[model samples]
Target: MPISRDDVLHVARLARLALTEDEVERLTHELADIVEAVGIVAELDLEGVPPTSHPRGLVNVMDDDEPRPPLPLEDVLANAPDHEGNLFRVPAWRQ
Candidate 1:
């Protein structure tokens, strides 16, 4: 699973990247190493291992939904830079 220099350049071209010779050479070696690592992982022996998104079990720890008193309108609008009645006001962008 060795990655070629041309393959790296092709990908860089598709991504609209202009890589220097030094960067291209470095990326080619790095990508080849990554592919080789993936190839080694592909040779694993796991017959009945279930695929999981996370290594540990996840549980919903959300609090019980409860109704709460609403804040005063004056308090809510206190920090607003500009407000008209109960809504925020902004400069008109269109005629």
Candidate 2:
């Protein structure tokens, strides 16, 4: 399938792009090549192939969840530049 100049113009318009004549001409050829490549791939026979999200299997490598002692309030606030009571102080956000 070949992409035309009109097709490129339409796509550019839909994408809200301001393309020059040279850019439109270049994209026409590039898009046509991409369409041809995709067409070739579509001709492949994969009837026996199973659908999968990932080609290789995925496994969780994270450590098991375990309860741990909490850090001391003084130790946690040691590096804080601005703190109120036991919590870090931050500027209020405005809408």
Best-matching candidate per TM-score: 2
TM-score to native of every candidate shown: 0.43, 0.45
How far out, in Å, is residue 23 in model 2?
A: 0.3
lDDT of 2 by residue, 1-95 (tens): 67889999999999989999999999999999988877886787989987788768776669879999999889999999999998899988755
Candidate 2 regions with alpha-carbon error over 4 angstroms: 45-95
Residue pairs with colliding backbones in model 1 are: none
Residue 24, model 1, lDDT: 100
Which candidate wins on lDDT? Answer: 1
TM for candidate 2 is 0.45
Per-residue lDDT over 1-95 for candidate 1, one digit per residue giving the tens place of the 0 to 100 score: 67899999999999989999999999999999888877886788988998787668776779989989999999999999999899989888776
State candidate 1's TM-score: 0.43
lDDT of 1: 0.91
The ten-residue window of minimal lDDT in model 2 covers: 52-61
